[model samples]
Target chain A: MSLQESGPSLAVVGVTGAVGQEFLSVLSDRDFPYRSIKMLASRRSAGKHLTFQGRDYLVEEIAPDSFDGVDIALFSAGGSISKEFGPIAVEKGGIVVDNSSAFRMDEGVPLVIPEVNPEAVAGIRAGSGKGALIANPNCSTIICLMAATPLHRHAKVVRMVVSTYQAASGAGAAAMEELVLQTREVLEGKPPTCNIFKQQYAFNLFSHNAPVMSNGYNEEEMKLVKETRKIWNDKDVKVTATCIRVPVMRAHAESVNLQFEKPLDEEKAKEILKKAPGVVVIDDRAANRFPTPLEVSNKDDVAVGRIRRDVSQDGHTGLDIFVCGDQIRKGAALNAVQIAEMLL
Target chain B: MSLQESGPSLAVVGVTGAVGQEFLSVLSDRDFPYRSIKMLASRRSAGKHLTFQGRDYLVEEIAPDSFDGVDIALFSAGGSISKEFGPIAVEKGGIVVDNSSAFRMDEGVPLVIPEVNPEAVAGIRAGSGKGALIANPNCSTIICLMAATPLHRHAKVVRMVVSTYQAASGAGAAAMEELVLQTREVLEGKPPTCNIFKQQYAFNLFSHNAPVMSNGYNEEEMKLVKETRKIWNDKDVKVTATCIRVPVMRAHAESVNLQFEKPLDEEKAKEILKKAPGVVVIDDRAANRFPTPLEVSNKDDVAVGRIRRDVSQDGHTGLDIFVCGDQIRKGAALNAVQIAEMLL
Candidate 1:
């Protein structure tokens, strides 16, 4: 693949979504070249006027012919919409980079976290006559793997246990608005409006709003387990997760425990993460300043900290790490954009 | 030891603090019999009026002579106060069940979780003309152990990993008030008050405010590790923890992973915990309702749920459990009062 002098035509699906908005911010920040861009949304949001990079654009209702001239389409409209439109976009001669879990686990579709598994998306690029679909890994998976894959590459991870502190943005733009509204209502001694979540979300956390599976793990957690195996391309690796919906507004935080097949010393593990691209090491013992959701809310880089030897394992056969990354940016839009950049 | 018909004299030190206030609630709710009671506090809280059990009482400043006729003292004053005053109460012929971490790891001082290790305070009684100090484990340790010990007894845990989602009450009464105030301020677009914690506690979670240790683990995390070994009476058990303080108000929750020396099937483990003392099983996958901080607030029993086999571990050698308990009640005051009841 080689960089082209002129970029391909791009389309932003679900332009009114939280992640969709971030796509524009990140595109503007990076100056991602695009010959033409289109904004597409649902019928209700279609006529809305949105300005991007100092130019006005109107959202068009997504149709069967929406991808007719689009060289690349970034989709974050819920899973159902992605499941329907993703294949249509690809079949219509447009490469689709999806943020939903639609085609993530399909055998033929590539689930790419560019920093962790760039090679999986090889031989695919924008403007190619044959269009294809590439899936973006879940937010929690992207943040955890951003720090873990560097160490996993050095010492193979045999098992992983993850606990996430997620924010409202994972649910979407209305959920974020609800969190703000609910907090204010709760503060004013009124009943909080529970539209998105069943239970109260102000100053509380619950199991991820994702429906629980019969196996007792929610879909959000299973995504970490299954997606890590696919992205790392190592099926023998074991993973379990307990996902919680915290009260934060945007960034997601995770406490990850890793057991390796081979010994990876803590200092060496820290050195590997420090040099890994797209990751910033924040392990400072003296300041007691590690990664917080508020610290990484709008940041592009996923922050890694609390790098220490797991006391449960003798010597350094295990390591524990804490990570934080913007839920909508790196976890969604920026990652899809990164995959698209690789396509060019 | 037989239960005494007429209970001994009881005194509550630091009666103005959060845990101190809960001491009165638990005592009155349980109908704990006491021949006489005294309210003790620092000079600042002295001369203040407090009513308990429909009787008005004045808070008295603690002096060396305060415990002359007192048979039992429930102390929740800070560690330094406990260090200076614990021995004085014991020397003045009163049994002290200290809530601070002062005497927890001492050679003869017993760390008691009434449900898990009641026998640790054996043969000690109020009004016996002799006194002894029994320590209450940290809130996180108590909640984790209340659920883990039942399974540990059946399978003999070899290694454990813990991650805590603690509440503001763990820091004390002022901290809880600050959380409410900070939430309102942040919701109004004003800077949050950061008096109790260094970072924002409104809609954010942070690594515990406890001091960081030399090994990069904070004091709160180490307390879970060391206290578990002491309470379980197994020094060889390997333990690691990452403690985080969430924005919740009262209850503390923990995600605990246990590796056992013997195989314990998930169904059998659930049955055992269903019958365990101080534990209530909430593992209903159908309802998708596991333990939440709000549900467990002001509740006596520790709520345990999300029990499942660790898919990472082969067969049944490992298990994962999530638990929540009242941080101020069972974690501190209720546990102290339970120890006092045993002293009778």
Candidate 2:
């Protein structure tokens, strides 16, 4: 299909989800080229009406036939749902861009971050399935690797030890509400019930929220470790992560220590990160200025700061940087929409 | 001295400060033996009356002679005051347990974390001008080493990567208040300002609060690196840490990944951790139960769970443990008082 001739048709699966909603907003804001829009969800949300670009559309129950006339499909539902129905959506002639981890590590599938590896998507149509499935990086990894990948181009990343300060949005809409409810409950002098989380999410922090694997890494931490390696396509890159959930609602923050294969001066490191795409440099030590979740929440650009050398090593050429990005937008929704836009 | 015999009096310096007040509470709660009690502070807080042991004591200005009859003096005011008056307190025949980092890392002085290395206090004596300056470990290090040291006893320690979810109390009382005030401002639709912290302390989490050294490790992160080695007394211990402040108040939590010289099995690791003193085993994965800040905030014992093996590395045992203990108690004041108990 020529860009000037037939416009693309987009289908949003899991239209009622947090990321699904972002897909709608990004398509509208970015003016993605689309002839028709179809919204699909679970049977419970089917028949619900939503409007995009001033046009009303009905949310239909997701089925094999849902993507018949669709050119692209965005999936942000759980992994089980994606696993059960992703191939069916692709079989119906729609290229699927899945946000879940279902097909992320599959050797045949392409795991992509548009800014990092756009060339990987060129062969999306030359696959065994009807359409290719592109995996979106995990929320924390997407936020950190966006800033790290640009720096990695200048210096080969030897290893990264990341500790994430994640927001409730990474867990989902229910976890977000749990934070609010738990906060209010604590304020009202009532005991907080650990429903959405294993512990109280009000005025508290936990090292692990997702189920911990036998590897001593929680689901969240493992996501950061694996997804970053896949997106950067550097399997030998050593990445260790500790993911923690804080009481924040939106932006996710990561403290990253990157050891370079060769010495890179602190000044050159800062300069490289400053000119990086989709990154805002905010390193002012005298003014106590640095990238923070409070500043980056709801913002599009990933904020990077605290650029300095790592002192523990004798040679001391390694740099430490902190990155913060909105978990909802750039991390999930906006990234998925950008993938679809690549095809357009 | 017998229990009924008169002993030299003890002084609590900086009684109004965060750690100072906690020392006062710990002294009484633990029933430390003292002939008399003297509460001391700066000029601003002097003359205020504080009650301990059902008796009121006057807060006096910290002077060179304030340690006249003080056999044991606990100091937490700041580094400068400790540097200026620590020797004077020692000259007056007082054993000083200094909580500040002033004398820590000094070749002559010993940094004591009672749980890790109580024998470090054996050097405390009255005759030397050294004044028995026992240093307390940094909060993050205190929490991390508490969990790892027990594991190290069974397996030789080699490398450790820890990510800290630190509480505002680790900063000071003002930082705690700033988190509360800024959170209220954010909820009320007002843009919160960074006052006590470098950025908004409310509804946010960020990594680089302490000065990031030229080595890429922030002051907070370096504390974890240096202090962990000191407390464990193993310079060969390779430690990499990322310290982050979350929207939490009192308890400091850590996610630790430790590599042992000898690989460990899960059952043996659990058995060792279960019998470890000051450590509570809460690893019940089936019921989704684990140690949490809400359960350990006011407690002295460090709560640990998620004991498992490292799937990422071969022949390296990994345990995903979440540890939480009151920063004000175990991390600072109570720890200093515990060191004092060793002296008496």
Candidate 3:
């Protein structure tokens, strides 16, 4: 049979999750090939009917036998769920592309951002008669590197300092709902209900809700620091970040400062970004318009703008750029599907 | 008359404006000594009545002769009004402590942040029978310098990078109200009302509404850069900033990266900030609590937290810090009032 007619069997673990639902949209948008598909979620979300590319499927509760006869499984459940089911799926003869943080740093598992480091998962493919696991980076890290990696390839980034204005969608769909509800209540002169977050999330911004590590950086910030080093394969590359959760809905905006070993002028940098794949330059200084979260909420390409020389660094060795991308798509589902596409 | 019985006669310009109203509250909170006070606004607000220090005063229209008997004039109307009236107030033999950007960069005009550079306006008193202009630095500059100056004094900052999360209050009282109104409208499935700001600000954040300069940095970002140099009296210091307006109410938070000429450990930096005047340290990593805009709203002190060594720089020459201060209090009115208090 032709490759198109005999595509690999697929299963979507955590089919009812935020990113999991997005995986279906991205898959349909790209018209990814799959011979057969199964839906899996927790017992609470089981039996839920979901439509994917005009086919109806009922999500079944995740179990040891769920991956039987499946060739590829996309997992977007929480970290604990991924840890419990990822190895089991691989043992059942299926490749797992996990959207959780469970196996991202595992030595044997390949952490990939298809556009940045596709070679990391070169030999891992569906229908190879062998099972393997590939890890998708954190949402913020995926969004940030989509812009920085191209620049890094040119200037050899020696150090990076990032400050993020993340959106509520990074937490989950439930958190986004709470943000809207809390905002409405606060506007009506009522006290806000803080459930997903410890503090008020309406009309105010705060540090990311991730647990703080002993080094004073939260887990989200550390993810950016550690993930960048591993993905770039540079153990000595220095990184620091401060991640904040703003009141935006779906996209995240970041202010990035880069110190490079080679000089990169603003004009050259702008030219490079304009030509880089998966990057849209929105640097319109005359119009006073730059990359904003609202403009890139549901967009696919990561927008880069406000490109300028870092006045703080002497010479042309430093540059600053602002970026924005959809947290659910480019940050999670879209990236995972792109890796799966390469597998075919 | 004894100095205690009769103090400087003060005039509050733009008495009907938000910062103008805040001037009254801060003055009363501190029980600032004054021989008498005048409430001055435009002809539009000439008939408005304002109560301060248990006394109700009618707002008066400003004219050339309004400063004839005034010892010190606190100006907060706008740039145009300050440009026309600041010099007139000074020419009328009164010290003009301006809260506008009109004279912040002028030669011989002192841009003072009491916590950072009280010496900038040294030996200038309101009752000296001579006119002078003591400029109140921009609100963001005052808040950032309050934290950076303490660390700079010890290590001598050579370069600084700042990313600001500003609030709606910086735009004015109407902007704050508009943010709340727009958020409510958007939540109810209605298009947001874009009166004060040109874009939707309810569930969104954007680059500062300040006009973007030719260098790709907005006017607000430039204010942070230029004002820091003038306040610190360090023309050699390099600074760059990206300022964005978040949906918070009255306080602003900033993430600052500082590169020092001398090596200052994080412990010593924390100790210095704890003792620094007008600064409160809130670094509690265990609780995942850091300085936030809500906690610092309407408060006088600039809260500094998240103090850590910048891993990007070696030899302890770099540090990262987060700071929050009431945009109306420490940023504008309180800083102006404190500058005026030095005249006592």
Per-residue alpha-carbon lDDT of model 3 for A1-344, expressed as tens digits? 11255788888888887888988888778888888888899999998898777768898999999988889899998899999999999998789999999999889888899889999988887988689999999989998899999889999999998999999999999899999889878877899999998888887788888998877788999899989999999988899998999989999999999999999999999999999888899988877778888889878999999898888888999988999999999999999999888888
lDDT of 1 by residue, B1-344 (tens): 11135878888999999999999999988888887788999999999999888889999998888888888899998898899989998888888999999899999999998889988988997789898888988889998999999999999999998888999999998999999999888877899988888889888888888988888899999999899999999999999999999999999988888899999988998999999988899888877889999889989999999888887788889888889999998899998888888887
What value of lDDT does candidate 2 attain over all alpha carbons?
Answer: 0.78
Q: What is candidate 2's lDDT per residue for B25-135, written digit by digit as tens? A: 787677777777778888999989887777778899999888886778888888888898888888777888888888888886788878889888786753343455677
Report residue B58 deviation for candidate 2 (angstroms): 2.5
Return the TM-score for each candidate structure.
Answer: 0.97, 0.91, 0.97
Per-candidate total of colliding backbone pairs: 0, 6, 0
A best-first ranking of the candidates according to their DockQ comes to 1, 3, 2
B49-144 in candidate 3: lDDT tens per residue? 887766789899999989988898999999999999988989988999899999899999999988788888888988888899999988889899
Complex DockQ per candidate: 0.76, 0.42, 0.75
Docking class of 2: acceptable
- For candidate 3 chain B, the 10 contiguous residues with the lowest summed lDDT are B1-10
